[model samples]
Target: MINYNNFIRALIIKNKDIVTAIVFMAIIAYVLPYYTVGGQGANAPSDGQSVGGGGAGGGGGGAGVTGVPIHVVQRTVFQRPYELLPCTQSVVELKKDLIPTTDFPSLVNETVSKFKVTVLNVYNTPDYKAMLLAEGDEKKVLQDPHFLPASATCGEMILELLPSLVPVTNIYDVANQVVSTYHVKVVDVYNMTDYKAIVILAEPDNAITKDSRFINYNQNNTLSSNYTGSGELDLSSGHIAAPAPVLKEETLPDSIKRTFTTEDLKGNAKSNFSKGVDADIAILDTGIDLNHPDLNVYRNVSFIPGGKTGDDDNGHGTHVAGIAAAKDNGKGVIGAAPGARLWSVKVCDKAGECKVSDMIKGIEYITQHADEIDVVNISVETPLSPALNRAISASVKAGVTYVVAAGNYGHDASTTSPASDPDVMTVSAIADSDGKCGGTGPALKAHNVTDDSFAHFSNFGPSVAIAAPGVDILSTYLKGGYAIDSGTSMAAPSVAGAAALIKAGDPNMSPEGVKKALLGTGSTPLTPCEGGPQGYFTGDPDQYKEPLLFRKLGAK
Candidate 1:
């Protein structure tokens, strides 16, 4: 056989490399069962728990079986924690035209779609901040993912849902998500067919402002009642005085004032109309004193936080209530429409300060009761707020007339809200000392306005739809007493009462119809002044004049 040992040696040498490869593969296969990248091993994720945390675009590693190391790569994707994710994208895009585009950062990574889809499952989590805190990197948490930095929330805001989100479920779903994602509390929620919004209370300088969807949401500002007197008059036990100023100025005859006629007990022909019967007027202000006997407060609600009953601790609402519809009960003071039912909507605190969101809440409350409520008296003044304006417009569309105070700053009424809004009936103030239209009455020099003329403190502009007696106005007060106050605040309620009277005449009258009736039947109180030919008031800055409010509309 020839060289058998040499043949065997050559075969062994040639197969040496293949034998070593097989052995290494066997070792790898055995180790994989207990150790793999980011898998269970001596030091890796165990029972679905993460090992170490990483900063943005960082990685971590742990020991594997036999002291070998296994490296794991952390995700590099970053996104706005409050951004609308892919789950809601399709639905949002369907109404893209209706939704305003928020200025959010562009997704830089091409892999963001996959990461966003993964985050959607955890989107409804109760607290993202807590989750990030557990990651043990507060600073990196702000930059990596899950929350906006503390710098994002600049002020308080009201979140407005797209009008197209009319469905209750959809509105709540969006609202809840927003509340959870932003870590903000919903102070109130407003949901109507045409309008949907929520008031979000945030820490100062928070980051929700960075979200594009809330770009239009403005900071919550303080609003206050427009009236200005603090002195109280004691009428607790004395003979309650009739509203002398109001009665003297209201020149409407009986025939014009009567809304319904019926036979008396003596079978004599008589009109039974007590004034504002069957009409409801909601006073949005500091609460009204419910115990005032002269007032026929039908119902009351408080929009102030932690407030229970709508009771006036501040007396402004009571004064306004008295001006609007105290009662014809021959006590305290008679209001413009004394027989009308009154509803106190307390939007302000005991200090007479209210938030813009609270005002919106008050309007929504009135709107919900629109079928029963005929008129709304808003004597508060605020800065120009688009959200407040929208709320008023929604209420007007619901068929309730809105009477707002023009303002007391003596500036352009157009600079304020609700007064500037086109849908509302803006009332300016006139100082009617003698209750007559002629400017012949002695000037109330101390109060800074002449009688039968535009009040020196009243805001004047073309937006003023009507004028009413505002200076030195006598009205019911808290603790079953009476008080004298002045401002466009006092004037607004007079028109509100007139609106109630108009609505009472024809319960089915539209808000516009009621407004038209008041405008059509108003008197020219300034006609007897020096500018009588122009119909403008004495102290008014504008050349154009608004008719003085006269509630009398002769028989239908």
Candidate 2:
């Protein structure tokens, strides 16, 4: 027609570089929007905005970006346009099997999961950090708020995903980022220690269980970490499926009998022994009877949601509290340390059921008041939880002594948390029916345990720190009355009181120092069952030496 072929060939030859440039621009125009549309492009995050999708425990995103931070990318390769829909819809409901397309550096759903995060901040004054220093005005520092209680949620969980797929710096950072991304309603951010555990309520299969931030994640049953974990609570009060056999409860008789365990421990040896005036003991249990006349409760707080008051709906806590620190009043039975201040940290429900997260929260409360609290008496038996252990380790590092029960399971105490932890003192039980040593006490035949002998129901092993009167122990009960009960639960508080007594004498003594004093001054090795074995109990093995609790705190 007009020499069109000739003309096209001439043009290509004249501007070959221009032609190549145009083709390259066309390819870039098509592929550029795919990576830049909703991710790291014009719709990028602003200052103070969190970048990341998925839930708070950091379970979101399909493929990770190499150079870019996982949190900042709006959309990733192969992600869908699910963010366009309302966040209220569940991930399961929105897309059956679709993966997140945008590599968003922001969270998807703000209110993802319920988690209680303990945020610690400095109690600094404008001029100087007085609260941090041990100065003259100690009372002022103790009164200052060291923790800002906060509740947070990440977005909805990504169903059936691997936890290790997403990487995080630490559990604390994950918690803080969740708070920021969700615009969590927090009064203030804590700046107390370098790190504070923020326990998450992740399921066993949740991605958080395998997160990189955790120190130890017990895959056997529960999930725990240096910063987060998940598990339910089992107080092990000789009830339910616990190893401690269930025992019958008895009402108080007309004549309130004197506590024989107190006398046996030499708690009543001196008049001053009845008054552990300088020490404070926190009871983490099913709560204490606030109105009990026989106990001197200093303060009470409950971590059970919707259960505000720290009242003992269950009698176990009340009984345990009385054994530790009943009043020296003439009406009620005297206790091991009658004047020790009691702080009721209720973590169990009315049925005595609890969650490990709640227990961690209680421990957080103790950590916040670590300066004022001297000892913590934990009478519960639970599986080894890294999260719970981490919290206790932090509290112990803050200078709080922890005393836990060896459990009533009649098995090795090495299987339980807190009891298994060597940092804290683990107390086993002794059936001192007459409250005297030498195995001379009466036998509790119905329970098949002899008097003044190693308790048949007490859990033992190398972890058992000490033994005390546990079987048939009578102490304070619910509704301001008295009752008789039995378990290692009773034995643990006895040692707790003894610890309080030691603290009363040496207020600045470390936890290790207190344990040494108890072990060094213990009286009488626990007698084995009659004709059972030289070192072993009736049904339990005692390859290791176990000392009985004795009061010899240098005239205190």
Instruction: Give the per-residue lDDT digits (tens) of candidate 2, residues 63-110.
Output: 212132111121112311111111110011112122233211111111
Candidate lDDT (C-alpha), each: 0.54, 0.52
Could you tally the backbone clashes for each prediction?
5, 25
* Poorest lDDT segment (10 consecutive residues) of candidate 1: 1-10
Show model 1 residue runs off by greater than 4 Å: 1-276, 525-536
Among all windows of ten consecutive residues in candidate 2, which has the lowest summed lDDT? 1-10
- How many Å off is the CA of 511 in candidate 2? 0.1
User: Candidate 2 regions off by >4 Å?
Assistant: 1-270, 273-276, 524-540
